[model samples]
Target: MDEFAALTERNRQLSKAMMQSVFELACDLSGLGPFPEQAAKARGTAPVNARLMQIQQLIEQLRADLQGLRGPYLMQQLQGLGVDQHSRALQLHIGSGPYVLDGWINLDVFPAQLSTNVLWGLPFVDGQCRYVFLSHLLEHLFYPTDAMALLQDIHRILEPGGVVRIVVPDIAQCIAAYQDGDTGFFRDRVEHWGAGDGQATRLEHFLAYAGAGPDPAWLFEAHKFGYDQETLIRALQRAGFKTILPSTYMASTHSALRVDEHSQIASAKHGDRHYSLFIEAIKE
Candidate 1:
């Protein structure tokens, strides 16, 4: 393993050990919480149990916070104006890989208006953006952790009634096609993007670019997770978004958020559906 990922894994191991120790402490304290007289504890005079519960809650929060950490390898790439509290443009195109918009800020790892890693967290203050769009970016981040962190951070930065549009590969459709032995779907998916060998089987084409090998750089660009319409909408709801809906290619209500990958648009132009799941959520 590389130095950075090795350090991260070691840190997580250490943290899990520490958390287990802390949870044991909490459990031990619970037995003594009502000691020296259960009456006083019942009357709220002895607040040991209450205090223990608070500590446990804090521990859970800290565990979640651990996922927010970014190794220096990734953190050093965070460049440009950190937090644009004064940016008048209300639209943000995060992870904009050549889908740069006219008025919105194009943010990516290479070169854009804001070249930084979103995994660390968004640099903008709360309610700074009216519309946020990220195409094929969520799947790149680790699911239920980095992905959720970014979604929650996006929700925090979006203004009330603001919108967040997410576009990702439709794993649901891929699985359906595989189960039905629909070679045409898999063939079209691979050919539409010209990203993989068209002759590959459904399973192979589905996971085509999931890291060329164990190399850290390749893994960094690979799809770490997949999501369907239901799971994605549920995640958005958990992020505190009020209204969530499944959308279509280039059919977003907001003109600024309609920008999508050309492959998705072209595939949809010829067929009723493509291998992209488009979903939108409104922060309220």
Candidate 2:
């Protein structure tokens, strides 16, 4: 037990030292001058990126330690992410990952993933979301019209400076892939689902009244309509967002692409042909 405690302390110290070294090196590269002592009083803390990275590293090290110990490791990791707050009262949105890193509220009209149903209607929230994040959610809706209305509702719910961040698979990119004749094998994956305006229920949607079904053009089994970057950007502008970040090639932008190793591996294996567009819009 004493040896285990000593190893844990050693790992933590190593992580902290690595972070401090990286920060100082960054400061040097930027010609920031030894991270001025005066800056400490003026700025009050470290930059957000450095802190977030440190937290992530610490989590990784702790997870490794838990595995070495062999029991309750996953639970410890979940506790680190605050996953203990799961509740039936909350409506979970579909495709929501375990953590809400960017401070988005887990909400949906239907409880699918990690959301509590329709947070917009809740009395105390007062439409003050920091940002609304949707992961491949919009394409599943049948009524693009009602989906636009939902965005407007989101705008209404947000505080003045708050923004919405949406990420959806781009249909145009897939069509471009098909037209380019990349690979006959890949062409088989092109689905042609149609969008119809009705209360469509599918097993994945839990047979609940989903606003619309998948568009039949690109995805036959279950995709409604695929969106190109232009269509999505224009739609958000019409929905009353004051500022929409310019859409660019996801691979090119620093902030646009999440550069995690897992994302890189997945993209490489699957030929990232699907279009994923992200939008950041401020409420007017």
Candidate 3:
């Protein structure tokens, strides 16, 4: 396992042990006796309950402390910006991968000055943002529930007429190409799959690229779920977006909400223009 995986495992084990210890302490203090029918009949139960509440409060405070520790530097940067600056910002780019725009606050999980964990929830106030953009990000989340929650959170942070533009790999197109026996599709994208020569079959290359490989990078970038137009629209609708529509690259109903030209140029060069699906949803 990589260092990140090992560290995450260790943290999980520690959290489990700590929770168990806290539960045991609470049980011991509460006693093995059955509950009394009346509060007046109970002897010293009030003290036990009070102690348990105190312990629970301490645990909650510890949780807050841990959250602070997870992203102290990011938090400092955000705080320095102040609430007014964040609220006044018109656009946000979630998981922005090198496609920086002039007016948008670009955020990512990796090494960026504005790095943020979106699952922890956005820092902006409700109905504060005018636009949010995400490109090739939803599939990286390991669960549909998590993706839905993120969408709902995005919806919460957007203005009533705000829009969220999303771009993701088109699974329908991939499957269609595969079924049509398009060997070139697999062979051409082999570099994205992994470091292997011409030895591996096209099927193997396709599988590796689709995230069934042994590479740690594949594990990190693997698509948990692929989406076509319909499924993606359903997800957005479920998140309370009233208006959802399919969009083409670099084009949108709203001029201000168009996809970045750099992203369009990159997509065209990468030969995934037809392999990607773009969708925009309005918060109305």
Candidate 4:
């Protein structure tokens, strides 16, 4: 870690020095200040200019690559493909890390159906999809901006009357369990994820998802925002969705979206309380 930090600083310093040298030479050459025959030698800058142009092109390409993991856009551009109406329905599992749904197109940043970053936008025409499933992904997006952008895009891509099932770590449930000192709840969660022996660590289990594993996939699941039932409902409503409902494990009206990791975790003892919030909303 120390070596990485030192190397990063050294690279920045070297880049700054290189830029300064280039700028000073360019200024000196332009005015013929250093040498009497500098005007004739000015043509030598053509190679430097060409190299800078190439560098600019490379920088622009990197900018696009960083932000333009646009799966649908790339599909259309590279493969001449877009999500057309499926023979049945266009179902999308956005941010589906490893849980690949058999029938639905598993779209995620973790190299699923397409390496898609949902924060940019879904790669489909408006009203092309029938159902979208977001599993424990919303909280990872920054609140009211990035999170809301994803929600608004989901509304736009769904056919009218289409549905979105959102899941997130239930902040309210976690808080309640902590207040009531429900060790069993914490115990179960810790055991399932295989960490957190104490009350505080177990509580941390529900709040944070990102720093748990070495995999980049888990790194993406960091809880940037927290959501309870009412807060989630209001966010959905703002995104132009209607008919929002607080749902439960394996109880979705949409049969295909009922596929979740929740059913196994929710215990029979704690009134079947799930560690994650399940909510569904309609694009109306």
Candidate 5:
């Protein structure tokens, strides 16, 4: 791997380790079973306690180091892309997984040749980008605070009157389906997308459809939170976006803001269209 890729991998490893350590600390403090035996053995020892504190301090330092690396790393990526910060015509697709547009910079967190992690912040001067697009990307973030921060970042990078199109799974539609006794719609369409083999039980299906799963990777891919129209509008307004309006698949108020049909359809199964909510907001 290249230097940037190697650093990114190392950062990811450190983040995972930090999370595990935090969980263990919680378990230890709570007197919960399944705490590491090593931790249990070292619990009452002064030297071990001092070492644990040192390790935590080291982790905090490493996290700060990683944060410092992000800006320069993203600037390098932009340089490689031949992107100019002064260019007013720059458009971006954030969290753009395998969705390439001819005239836009497509970015994602995954390790890909074309994708870059956008969580660091947009690699542009304020008001440099004319348009931004992200579809079904917000729900993966585990915190609403992070989501709002990202939206505000996007707003900061966008030019005056620049539009951002967002699409997310409609939580309202999911609730309606559940209430209307169309559980199969949620089960078959959202959870599993294959011929019925009767593999999962009803409870398992419901949990999976609701974005709860046992797999560790699900923490990254599964929906952490859901939003209805009003909630999304409020978030946009909070992010300094005015003129927020509802939209539909492949449709927008301006022709220039049209959704990429290839990307949109490729992201969904046959009957999954109705489950998505599309909205556009302008930075004014």
Candidate 6:
């Protein structure tokens, strides 16, 4: 284990060096001055560049494989390929990750199972998915106009009666949890769950500020905006999704819709915080 740890540390340093060298080359290509420290610092800032995030995710997967841990994104990719442990039928999965949720195809811009543009190119989209799962994904898009247009494209891609399962952090829920007394507790929860680390706890409030770092608050700086339940419902309606009642939705719940234990670990019991939400909208 100690040898493994030593090797991991050594590899991390090597990876950083390789990444820095690449960045330096990019700067040279663009006629910029040396900024190795700045480049390294940029690597950690919020609103992580999509391309950089993809690279980081790939590295993390490689590290996981080296450490004999499950490669986080591999399951999603396998699920996209219909080789998942459960052997479930796969569909379209935009921005795949930790959850290789059943029925998602694991699409990204960098071309794994599928590739799309900033708005998920509608042209290459296979109009066959029963459900389009965007778990913790949409928050990274920068332009709402482009995003709405993409949503429209998504609307076009779904078969009749298909559903777009959208999961995102409920910003209003966080605000309410923070303001209705017990500010400190909710703040801590927001920091812990929102940023996925301890540093964000200190800058939680800055999330509301424009141009703040992505690592500071919210899931990503690319999280250009957020929504409350009402706004999200309204957005779905505008995008041609029939708003599903929680009871009815839960009643007809597909096997894929079951929330996992990890997803629920820090729910209301964990300091009255509001972290995430899943909404299903059927094309009517």
TM-score of each: 0.66, 0.45, 0.68, 0.66, 0.80, 0.54
Q: Number of the top candidate by TM-score? A: 5
- Residues 1-284, model 1: lDDT tens digits: 89987887787567666656766676776767646356666786856567667878997798577555544333443333343456533788888876677777778874556666787678777898999988888888877889899999999999888999888878777778788898778665655566544467666766653322222424556777778889898899899987998898788888777677443432342256767788999988
Q: What is each predicted model's overall lDDT from 0 to 1?
A: 0.73, 0.48, 0.71, 0.71, 0.72, 0.55
What C-alpha RMSD separates each model from the true structure? Answer: 10.9, 23.9, 9.8, 11.0, 4.2, 10.7
TM-score of 2: 0.45
Model 4 weakest 10-residue run by lDDT: 210-219
Error of 4 at 126 (Å): 0.3
Error of 4 at 127 (Å): 0.2
Angstrom error of the Cα, residue 170, model 6: value is 0.9
Q: Which residue pairs collide, candidate 6?
A: 46-214, 46-215, 91-103, 91-105, 92-105, 93-105
Which residues of candidate 5, in runs, are more than 4 Å off?
A: 1-21, 32-44, 47-49, 112-116, 190-218, 264-273
Candidate 3 residue-pair clash tally: 0
- Candidate 5 has its poorest 10 consecutive residues by lDDT at 264-273
Worst window of 10 by summed lDDT in candidate 2: 259-268
* Clashes within 3 Å, all models in order: 0, 30, 0, 0, 0, 6
Q: Candidate 3: misplaced stretches above 4 Å?
A: 1-66, 70-72, 80-86, 191-218, 264-273
Ranking by TM-score: 5, 3, 4, 1, 6, 2
lDDT of 4 by residue, 1-284 (tens): 59987887686566566666656667766776546354335865545456668978986897689565555455754243344544325787787777777767777763456665776677777887889988778877878899899999999988888999988778787777777887787776656655644555644655564223222323343567778899999999999987898898778888777877533432222446667788999888
Which of the two candidates, 2 or 3, achieves a greater lDDT against the reference? 3
Better TM-score candidate (1, 5): 5
lDDT by residue for model 2 (1-284), tens:
59987887687567566756666666674786545544655798776556658977998898688556533533454344354433212122223544333433343322222333221222223444444555556665544674676667666656776656666665555555455654432322322222243332232222111223322222312445566778787878877886877543333233422322222211222243333555557676
| lDDT (Cα, tens digit) per residue for candidate 3, span 187-208 | 5454443446667764664454
Residue 269 of model 6 has an lDDT of: 32
